[model samples]
Target: MAADVKTHLYEWSTTEGSNLPVGSTVVSTNLDDNLRMIQAVVRYLASSGTVASDTTTDIGAVDATFLAVSGTTTITGLGTVSAGVYKFLIFDSALTLTYNATSLRLPGNANITTATGDVALFLSLGSGNWNCLHYLRKSGSPVTAGSFSGLTAAIATNTIANGDYNQNWTWTKTTATKPALFIGETTASSATDAVILELTTAAASTASAAASQSAHFAGICNRRIRRRQGVFGRRLLVVRYAD
Candidate 1:
């Protein structure tokens, strides 16, 4: 059988039997070639020169385990997808890595717009399929969710300010007016006060959370405050955040 070009692994024919005679030069050659292939694999890292990748990457022609890839074309497949085959890719430029359920799987089941210095490791599952094992970005962040840090106290559209739990925001509303809830998502690595607030409506009122830098508000909260009437009495209503 023909040897695999990528790993130089020789496959014996079905009819071929082991414990054959030593007079066969083909058997000796195969043994030597297999030894060399083992040595190459033991070396761990074989780097291919920077090359542009395409829809169907042809790393099979390159005798390397690590590839530095260029170009912006989306890559859908790698090599021929032999089971147990592994490839480490280092992107030299921005490109899109297409995600497929079977053919070319990715970390988040979403296409990745790779940046330079991004590295990804993939393993083949045979039947023309590849699965991404790990993906690392030079920016120290994944491509799954959008996040921001060092949020200031400035209240603008779609931006949150750093504050504490006791801080209160008030909104004036008529009997026909309704209030919308705002949600904030924070990462564990982020500071306690770091938050990304999302407003449900444009007319939704904003509030600060706290005074200290480490203060933060989490989960749903409800507050009751009185709104001044024309001159004499006041009306009280509940300001609550929806789940």
Candidate 2:
């Protein structure tokens, strides 16, 4: 008697202008299927990297890169940066910083200074790759001298008039530990408000909670269904095969 061998071929399709939501099971098939799924994820991330519109209220979403500030106020939030380089995008009218620790000062040659409504960028150094260890910010008022132990350097300040706006802060993190990314919003009459801090890095020392396996193939089938649709629309497929 001869041994029997079986092979399976799968085909799926979707119409245009449809949003495909992906789940896990469909992602664990063969190397080819996995690679196609990963490519879709990368495309989604790349598309989200651009900045979005602003809002009147402080509440907003942080895409790959989008920040919006409204009114005159001050707010504080925590930033737990991973051990890698990062860019901090500030989308506000005016801002100021108050370092929480002396060691958190920006590099001397970073060229970060305080000015009313001036767009600026700062680079952090020393730790992993010049990332900030810790820091703070204040709005509605210029950062006063002696706000922190390391008062030798001038704080970066920007001023914005009524109905005017300023945005874009590109900073790099060079440390493994997380730090605070603060913001201060200066309103028209010297008053200020604060915006929330949006985190960009993945959680430290945490594992994904997804299950290892499942019996139902509907979840998996739906994933393949979505991928087939995405590939047809995007016209480009990036596949990574690993056994």
Top candidate on lDDT is 1
**Candidates' C-alpha lDDT:** 0.63, 0.32
Model 1, 1-243: lDDT tens per residue? Answer: 322223542122223443232344364436666566556755645555555789888654455678899788888877574477677889998988888897889887899999999998888677778888999999887668643445566476674454454545455655443444444444343564332432232244464322234243432235433343443233222234344
**Candidate 2, residue 96: how far the Cα is off, in Å:** 2.7
Candidate 1 TM-score to native: 0.51
Runs with alpha carbons beyond 4 Å of true place in candidate 1: 1-7, 10-38, 41-49, 146-243
What is candidate 2's lDDT per residue for 49-157, written digit by digit as tens? Answer: 3232221111112223222333233222123222232334343444333233332344332323333333222232323223333223434442333234354644887
* Model 2 bad stretches (over 4 Å): 1-33, 40-78, 102-104, 107-243
Whole-model lDDT for model 2 versus the true structure? Answer: 0.32
- Sliding window of 10 residues with minimal summed lDDT for model 2: 2-11
Could you tell me the TM-score of candidate 2?
A: 0.26
| Ten residues in sequence with the least summed lDDT for candidate 1 | 3-12
Clashes of each: 3, 27
